[model samples]
Target: HEAKINGLSITEVDFSTLSDDEAMLKVMMIDEPEKLSAAIAQLPASLYEQYNILQSAPFFLEFLHTDSHKGIGVKAIAQQFGINADEVICMGDAGNDKQMLEYAGLGVAMANASDDIKAIANHITASHNDDGVALVIEEFVLNK
Candidate 1:
């Protein structure tokens, strides 16, 4: 429905049913109702019930990630880039990117980023619509 509305192609994958290698590079899309429904159907009965309970709770999304997922994602990115986590620089304006930004050597937040994000960043550049990314690249990466 989203793709149809936006005039984009839509592909779906059920991650829970896929092998690790099969799922590794797949761009997981949770925005599609059909795909989400299919993925949810693959969960164990017990886990499914737990998911339902959590879904009804106020803190559902906040509690979704266990510590292991956090560590694994960071480790995987570091390994794939063949660089120490401290050597990387990251910039973003969302809550979900907080961990990645904190792990980077230079974590930059856009001028329009939330106060919380700015607090965690080493620097704050202009907003995306204002070419903040280019400014940062020119001043820090290119000039240096």
Candidate 2:
């Protein structure tokens, strides 16, 4: 439904029946369709077309979700970087950063932050122009 709404072509992969060589070819096709096509031409006719369609569909989808409007992608990045949620610290001046601020072990809202965000943070720091991020990092992260 999402793909249909977005006008994207979708293909489903059934990994159970694919052989090792077929899987490898599929992966290669996804990464480099043109190159894979040239190479596949040298393979048997049945296998050539079998793997060609693999590259014709979208290879990746990006999803964004956040505790606050702006923090949606932040969680994904933290997970990708292998950073522990407890070890992370976040500071922000706007509502979008609210979720990131709350997710971190130490959440500092800018002195200029919205009241709602400030209320949810562990502390309030200086405004952005005053180097709020630097001040908090020095006082809590470095000095600690």
lDDT of 2 by residue, 1-144 (tens): 445667967777777877766623123233344655465456666653343222222332111221223345667778899988787888876544666787787889888777777899999999998999899989988994
**Candidate 1 to truth, TM:** 0.53
Q: Give the runs in model 1 whose Cα sits over 4 Å from its true position.
A: 1-63, 67-75
Clashing pairs in 1: none
Give residue 104's lDDT in candidate 2 (0 to 100). Answer: 84
Candidate 1, residues 25-125, lDDT tens digits: the string is 21323344455546555766775343211121111122242332333477578889797877777877755556667888888888877677789999999
TM-score of every model versus the real structure: 0.53, 0.50
Q: After superposition, how far is residue 85 of candidate 2 from its true place, in Å?
A: 0.8
